[model samples]
Target chain A: MSIRQIIDWAIEDSRSQMTGTIVSPFYEYSDYGGHWVWACDVDLGENLGVLRCVPVAANNRELIYAEQGRAVTLSRLNNGKWVITGLAKSLNSTVHYIFMSFTDDTYQVLRKQLRGYIIRPLTYGELGTLVVPYGYGVLPYGAQGKFDAEGNFLEIVETY
Target chain B: MRNISAALENIILGGGTRRPDYKVYAWDPAEATISEVVSANGILDDPAPVDLTPYVSDVSWSDRQLTFALVDPAGLFHPDFGELRHCLKDGAILRLLEGDETVPEVDWAITFTGQVHGQIGWKQSRSTGQITSRLTVFGRGETQAYKRRKITSQEYTVGTDIGIALYDICKTFLGLTGKEMRIPFTLGRQFKHKTNQLAQVTPWDGVCSLLKVVCYQPFFDGEGKLSYVNKSLHRPAARLFEDGDRIKELEVPECSQDTVNKVTVTFLDSQLERVDGPYQKLGQAQVTTGFFSMHETLETWWSEDRKQRADGTSMKVIKSVNSGILPVGSEHYTQLDEFHGQIEVEISVWVPILATVMIAEYLAAAFIPDDVIVLGFGASEGITIPVGRIIQAQAMIGILLIMMSIGSAQYEVWGTPYDFAYLEKKSVAVEDGLDYWLENNLDIKNDFIGTHDQADIIAMTELSWQKCLSMPRKVSVADDPRLEVGDIIGLPDGRKLVISALSKNIKRGEIPTLLIEGCKVLTA
Candidate 1:
């Protein structure tokens, strides 16, 4: 049986007290089943998170922003890892978007190291680093971020 | 008051974090095995907890009844329409446990233990869509079976120990084991042996007769064991409650108008030797017939006791009949005609003395021709014999008397005397105190009472209780499983009362409450 649901439950339980927008992992991955997983990271501002999908067969990635502000949480099935769902909105589109670095064996290994953003491999074998998705232009305390020239997000400074 | 632990007390007082819960188990006494009927934690294999709501337990000095509803959505408890229907067997014991989840089950207090009393049934709520199975259980010792079952015909001799006799009855008639009873060694009463002791009563009445002889009463203790205790003994008060002590309500009812102000006990004196009536005229009847036959009946004032008689002789029919005709002095040639016919008769009567019947029959015949008539009496066609002269032929005839046996009581063969040979000596005891006098008198008739001293003791003891029964007091308080009947408790007014009845209702998420009723205890 997959422990991915258990991890998802842990994350949901841990995030119950969190009020700000959550910049969850946006990297699209195919689960044990053929279903595609979506990116759930959203902005806490008036704008919403962008829905992005990258099919294994399609060469180009698609992106579409949410129609209205939405909240996100992770859910899972017995077939695979986790699915990011928007509360009451549909934003199915294609575009390059931000994502978290943690997943599977790689995330398990990086969790034990220095507590900071770490680089990890994407589904298409492209390299990406985890982004805090906060303090973007025209948004305060929202989880929206812009990437650098090499498609790398700037490391967020920890105030704690 | 009822020996509850400190932890349980804390929970009841709202000082403990563990919530109070209840569990009920169905126990088979025959197999000595127990199965969970319902509990707060549910069954071992099944995780769904059984609903125990609308629970009511009413316990009194003479009875203990428990009623509760188990919400059965799956129909597990339905008797007629369910996949896993449970048919509770007769005499199946239901044990109630009151405890919290934090405490081990073994440490839970068994508030009640009773047998299923044949009231189990299921009902569906139309509004709530809930199917509930209701069960009613009666305490084992207080089951109506004892009051309904009659003890077999038996006899107890003089000096027979009442305690031993009660033990035998509970074991043999009631089918109770030694562990379920607490019989005293001797009840301080013995058979007087004057009037033969006979057991022709129900088991409950039998026990009552034996115990009342010693001034005791039968009750099932809190643990569901039979106990015979004397209420006259002064026991220490269990607890004292003041005006503000967890007491929700209190009331004292006025004395009833029918309260007994005087008690008169009348019984037979068994000490005096037996005495017979003056010659005791048994019965008499007359018969007159012309055809040498006659029939008549004699009504008796008292029954004829053949086995035991006041004169120490077997019952003998002694009677005299007047033929009402002068005997003609004549030789063989001129004798009245000898009538040739047989007499047949039957007589039925009731006798209150011996509680038995005595019947005697006589048959006589004579040979004479009906052609010749030479006697100076009635006409030849209507000759009367036994009461008038019989002119059947040329000969005269005289009737002869024959005797038969008498009938006695039904249990005469069992050797238990159904009737006392001596006349009963009435003994009366009166108690009419001016302070609480209402002129309501009580007349008690007890066959077991043999002496005037015993009669006085019984009357005075009964009067003492009748005086206090008028002042009934009721109180409502937070539920305490420890409270029991016969407990002497102090009231807010400082008067001591003996609990006679109590009722309690248990529900989840609700604090149970108790309603108690008692009678004031009169000080000596």
Candidate 2:
């Protein structure tokens, strides 16, 4: 019913192909209403790599790779490799499984739709583990996915 | 000495005196000849010390005199002589001796004579002149000096005109000098007297003019002339101020007792009427209304009839009245226009008259403490009919009924209407007959025909009708016996009277009628 619910449903549906599970839900900071970012660890059974994803809105997704103390950009040549850049915490020595998820709405519409969903009844401690993860990757390979609960690929919606 | 003489000459040429306060003499030796052979008889030709002293007596200088002898006949060797001869040549000089070996006690005299020689054969051009002068010399002693002494002398002459000019220059110079000294001085005193006099005079003239305009005097017979009376007499010490400072103190003359008495009479007649009489009447009226229902009734009536018709007739009757008299289906028709034309002039005049009476009654009701009411209706068919009033006749009957109810209640409570007279007296009362009619007819009543008493119904109806009436009533007691019977005889229903014996005992006087209608009705 709400944008957050839609994002959660998309993330949950994408978990089958995802190599990692969500370790933390989206943490919010005020930037145009509010911005949400999350990090997760993916297994990537064949080789260990990292994936970082920033979801600005339902459709806007940026895939990154987990690196030493940062999330670095992943080139098309290194597709499916996760390189972390501008991470608040260090990911240098230990290998992490990164996951990314996105929905298909604009930030404004998404915010308006998720107003009630964002202010859920969950306490601070419970919300830490309740978040869902979709795409996953390793350090050399970045993962990407079309996040949608009803199988509709995320699409950019433009407003004047 | 020669330089000194030259300097003296220069000084004299420079317009100053070259001589001191003493005398000077010039000498020449050329005029004298040595007579050495004259003493040939004197012993040996060697000119034995022939004691020339005897000749010295004639040549010696005395005290206060000086003599010089010239030895050379030329150059600087010139001698001083007492006289110079004209025959002497310019280069001639003789030895000259001067002596002052004389007694100091005697004043000495010196004489010098100089004769001018004319140029050869120029006697026609030359004037004969001789210089002879005497000098009285006084000193401690005299001397013959061969030594040269330098002397300098100077002389100056001052004319009166030049001295005056110098004095003027000095005066001007002194004046400038005094200015340069920068001494403080008083220039002149301020001339305030003229300004002050003008100031006082103008204001004085203004004050006099103001007094002439504002003051009055009352003349008396056989008395001395009286000054103008000051109207500010009560406040004599009043002062006027300019810019918050007192500028003038007003003096008010004392008013005579007679004048004060007259003023008191005038004040009592005019000003005191407003303060005392009206206020007392208002106070008394307020008290009566506070305990009575007079104003409530008056207000209700005025508000209801403010824009309505005067005679309280319905629209149908009013139109009928305007149409005059007409019979049904009569060919001899009375058209409304004709009927109105016939009555228009009379109605116009009569309406104003009735309106004047009504206005007078309203003014009396508003300001006077006497009950006065305007009955807006007149009886039409002698059935005590009130047809043409704006308010229903029954409504006026209601005011009377209310008043009678109050009166009877007061009588029952206090034993007499007079006992509550203070509570009943009012200046104005307006009754809206409509409100009573509506209330009595439309309002629900709980009790209905429970008591079958005819007298009670009559009494209640009488009281109710009195309460609804709007006519004025005066309270008084009957005073005459014969008039009582006459009053009963004038009643329209007198033949139907039941209590004749009791009616005979009633006193007669002109008390206010209690009927709500315009006409007065008698009752026995």
Candidate 3:
């Protein structure tokens, strides 16, 4: 086999091995209609390997949108919009993971897990129009990057 | 230059029915960030909070003077004047934006931004029965913060790229982000900075000196970002100022006072000198003590000498390693004259014996022996005396006599070599027997000329600039809000003038006139 085929096989094997739950939490709905899930149809378009997900709020829902060849975390706010929190490696096949919680503590645990990575909070405007991220503060941090990827706090080097 | 919309340019060229007007805004320094203040436009929601356009009067802005007045008649302004007073405190931001009367507020472009300086003074006119409060402010550009940051001591070794050093200084000391700076690509001139010489200089001056090496000047554009510019580059004409244009007055004066037929640049040069080593083995001995088998290795290298520069002053040698290379040991380090010397030595090991290896490297510098000198090293045996004593003992016994004098070993003497200062001058004569020579002996204290080629380039640039400065024109025109510093205006005589400095005053119910100083005029 060619080197590219060998690399693809190794990547597929690694992706298969990493298909497990990173974190799980219990959630309950008052309506007894089962916990709400912020699931959306995967949009790969002409590009089949990449997943294009819109930012949404997930106030009271579980996020389960997934695509092939890519792995990412989607957090839902109480307002039912889902947002991308972090990116992941190892996703050779289509996989979906639902993360549901009753409080912000579960997301805090995930934030602690992916410390230094830049986490963007995707939000929506009135009329259900998706508000594209603009300026800087759209992330949880507004130009002030606090935690690094390894969960280590960085020292602020400049003061005005 | 700030790019204006075509409609705005038409308004400036006096082609529109609506005339240009300016609005002033004020923000407290502690209450708002510069990014917010810079991007603020009072369209719907005011970002700067306070509008000072109603009370602002006698507004004038120039390179040297930026002053305005706020008039109050029997306190008719009431709470608005009080609010304006609160916003006009010291260090408060004063922003001026220009737009026509009928245009949308978003079309207004910022004309000037400054910070309040000193105390706001008040004066009363009994005849007019009105009290005037005058406020003076200083233009705070991008380099203003860097001008306050002082670097006590810093050094860049010879062959250091000027561009990278400047970027490092801006990033480390000024805390400027990558987007805030636009340094040109690395010109191939190497820069060397002496720590003692640049012991106390602000980052602004440091940046200016580095830019001066490439004949460039540092300036802040309208967006308040630091940029390097070379005026020698020809720029296309921005606008033509001819008849029917709103020009008040124009004068082109020819003077030979600034004409240069010669330019002299004095720079320090490193002159190399070679000195052989003071390496010698006084004596070797084999002794067997209470051990079954023993082997020992002993080697020594030492030098003692002093050299002076061509200026007849004692040379000061400094140990400096290249940015990435590491020094081997205390005895194996590179040293050069503190002021003007380049590092030309390669790192290598010198072995003396086959069985045992010795790393002998000499970057030795001049030594001033005002007192006693002693040199010592360990031998094969455990107990030992000083090498001087061993020499004395050998001389007293007369059996193992070996004279260890100066220049005994065949090794290279490594120390700071004497360097001298030389003047590299370039000249261009415009006419024979009519020499209008303007010479400038640049003080090495102010100029950073490290290499000979760099000095030549700087001298040529100075010569060209001086030649261009021979013809300066002062032009007075109606205030055009679209006009900016560094804009080129075409003259009537098929010549182009680059606007170097400008002064203007904006008043109500009257035309604002501009005074422009064009330092260089080129053929159209």
For each candidate, what TM-score against the reference? Answer: 0.49, 0.08, 0.49
Tens-digit lDDT string for candidate 3 (B326-442): 221111222233322221323223111210211111111112222323434544445333444444443333321111110111212233222222212121212223322222222
Question: Which sections of candidate 1 miss by over 4 Å?
Answer: A1-160, B1-19, B28-63, B81-84, B87-91, B100-103, B125-128, B194-198, B242-244, B254-257, B272-429, B433-439, B508-511
TM-score-superior candidate, 2 or 3: 3
Models, CA RMSD each:
45.8, 66.1, 34.8
Worst 10 residues of 3 chain B by lDDT: B400-409
The DockQ-based CAPRI class assigned to model 3 is incorrect
> What C-alpha lDDT values do all the predictions have?
0.47, 0.20, 0.46
Those runs of model 3 whose alpha carbons end farther than 4 Å from true positions after fitting are: A1-160, B33-36, B39-47, B74-83, B125-128, B141-149, B153-164, B167-198, B221-223, B227-229, B242-246, B253-261, B267-302, B305-450, B508-511, B522-524
lDDT of 1 by residue, B1-524 (tens): 35566677667655445455677666444544222322222222332222232232222212377777666777665667554333345556666667776666666666666777654787888898977666777776667877886667356666777777777777777766566666686777776654344355788787777777666778775556566545552567776776667788888877535555555554545554432222222222233322122233222212232222222111222222222232211111111111111112322222111112111111211333334434566555553344211432212122211111221111001111112232232332233223323335565656666665665566556665665566788888776666777677887777787787777776544556678888777765
Which candidate should be chosen as best, given TM-score against the real structure? 3
Candidate 1, residue B59: Cα displacement in angstroms equals 14
Scoring only the A-chain of each prediction against the true A-chain gives TM-scores of: 0.23, 0.18, 0.19
**Docking quality (DockQ) of candidate 2:** 0.00
Better of 1 and 2 by lDDT: 1
**Model-by-model DockQ, in order:** 0.00, 0.00, 0.00
